[model samples]
Target: PETVTAFQLQKQGSEGSSGERALGQQEGYRVDESGKVYLPFIGEVQAAGKTVMELRQEISMKLIAFFPDATVQVRFLNFRVTLIGEVARPNAYIIPNEQLNILEAIGMAGDFTPYARRNSVMVMRERNHQREFVRVNTQDTTLFKSPVFYLKPNDIVYVEPLKAKQYATQGDFLSRYSPIFFPLVTLATFVLGLSVR
Candidate 1:
């Protein structure tokens, strides 16, 4: 999945006379275009369609063939989210951690602009090959409990612009109507000049 770009795999260390030193041989793996992760002994393992738990289990099973007491942990790395429209800085940001909320995501984008509609923020997400859209109201206290409060990897957050922005940019009456009436005014001026001559 595009959302899952990289992950880390850790193998638990065995207890010794001085006790275990936490994890052993922690390695970072990147998912290739074909959605496969290449490990030392396991070769290429398909990681695209599998969940975190499934991938961890598969890796553990494979590692056990080499080490009788293999304990494996898999976690996503390089979490990212995109923000667009009516924000101070609209761009894709790489989050350092997995847990991210709407407020934090907005903050990462440098907050909303003055013309932003805080009550009409939208989130676009893709899961299991299906796209889902959700609206969030940053002005409401109840937003804390919303399902979209916590953003997922590759999720897009869009802040809508207020009608005031549109009205302000519409320009004055003359500029707006000149395009339609300028031709008629020119034609009439030519006709009047001919009549007077």
Candidate 2:
């Protein structure tokens, strides 16, 4: 879930005033599952497809009638991204600010794992009610200027594992069951040794 904070400011005097004071400390509005923000007098307003600036403008226009000098500053409270697959820590992170590059997000996940494929990193993003996938190469310098370089809210970074890692996992499965098969072979060898003696 995402939330927005609206900072309301009002001019001091009815006439032109150079000074302004905050109406309150801060007013937080939670974007519900339906993607709408509920205001005091405005009821529910759709906040999903709108940017922070747009939401601010909409809210300011709605409140202008009640508070003539009202001005609003809207900002998203949480910027979340998920790192999965071959990263050191496969988990979701809440970024402190809105601007976060792909490398920075990877660093927050403790970098990639030993088996991570640096050339084939995948970024899954959801924008404007649609999901999209992008491939980024960590080793390439061009990644810096890529459109997908900057991550957005609810973005997912997936680092693919190398072939060696997949083979090692298969080897592990056999190793886990080897003890059960090993004992039977050892018993047959012991019986053959006794018969030969």
Candidate 3:
């Protein structure tokens, strides 16, 4: 409110414009052959392997040196995560924001089916330029603390199946072994009706 002067007012929205061109971003842009981006102020930030937050902070620091008294906003203009393996819809979803989590991803895939193994969910993430694997068990309530609970940009979630699903499916092939064939409750009801008759 104190910036009544025209000079101070100009700084309100100016993003430290140093005549740099706005960069085009994609939904998790593929690393260029050089594995980098020619950012406005930060130059070629090591983006291919860094997380969004890491890149943001690095750019913020670099911008501070140049802007001095300005504010900068860094964001992954486009990002996504892939959910595959047994999910109803196994595809890459553009994560418009960072609020997405494991449950949210599963929800996006139409939730889990009876065949899905809630305990065998897996996530693939990159850390320090190295790929890492993590497991998630939706049946377990403590999954909130599991490292894989959060879906990062480009994370892949896989929902496996339990053996019981296959075994139960097998019984359907044989009439005598059919899981729906033997209902003792039906026999008990029949006998009770006979007595009533």
Candidate 4:
């Protein structure tokens, strides 16, 4: 899926020429299941197997005959990442630009929580219809050299919580009844003070 914008440059002395006019607004082009994107004048172009830059060049070359002074810009609008688990916020984020690194993706999710196990971060990816999972330690400097360090579209990053977080929840029984327990304790203390006075 990509967004293609075509701008027609106008001459300085041209009357009624409003600088540049957009060809068809900011239209979003989605590649069909067969991996082709259909444009108005250019018909269908193979997009699935090609990068945004390649598609832009192909489109620009094709549009030369129609509008010689037209400038074409292509961008992937569907590039997204999923961040879950121990991060401060867990959600799917649509990145405006295609370029994204692991650290930037994590930062977008408000970074990892205090209980997050930074040493064990997992990235899930899909390749050739097969799922691939990779584990990397954020504390390890070697992670910079890992190929998975850079995130791809639809990649999922999961941060596991430390054992202490689990134990804290399980061992703290009062947390579940705080609403009633706090009121009862306050009433009991008030009654005892009145009797002593």
Candidate 3: the clashing residue pairs are none
Best by TM-score: 4
* Residue range with the least summed lDDT across 10 consecutive positions in model 2: 15-24
Q: How many residue pairs clash in each candidate?
A: 0, 0, 0, 0
The clash tally of candidate 4 reads 0
TM-score to true structure, per model: 0.63, 0.66, 0.57, 0.73
The TM-score that candidate 3 achieves is 0.57
Cα-based lDDT for every prediction: 0.79, 0.78, 0.67, 0.79
Q: Which regions of candidate 1 deviate over 4 angstroms? A: 1-27, 33-36, 44-73, 172-197
How well does candidate 2 score on lDDT at residue 54?
A: 87
lDDT of 2 by residue, 38-155 (tens): 8776778899888878888999899888678876767655466788899887877655454889998888788989999999999999876788999999999999988889988888
* lDDT score for candidate 1 against the true structure: 0.79
CA RMSD for every model?
A: 11.5, 11.0, 12.7, 10.4
lDDT of model 3 at position 37: 65
The residue ranges of model 3 lying beyond 4 angstroms of the native Cα positions read 1-35, 48-54, 57-71, 126-131, 168-197
Per-residue CA lDDT of model 4 for 106-151, tens digit only, reads 8888899999999999999998889999999999998899889988
Runs in model 2 lying further than 4 Å from the true structure? 1-27, 68-71, 127-130, 170-197
Compose the digit string of candidate 3's lDDT tens values, residues 1-197: 33323113111211115321122322322346565766544567677667668877776788787667655444554356777777787766665465678998888877887788888899999776799998878888989998777777678788887787778767656656545555766787899999999
Q: Which sections of candidate 4 miss by over 4 Å?
A: 1-27, 174-197
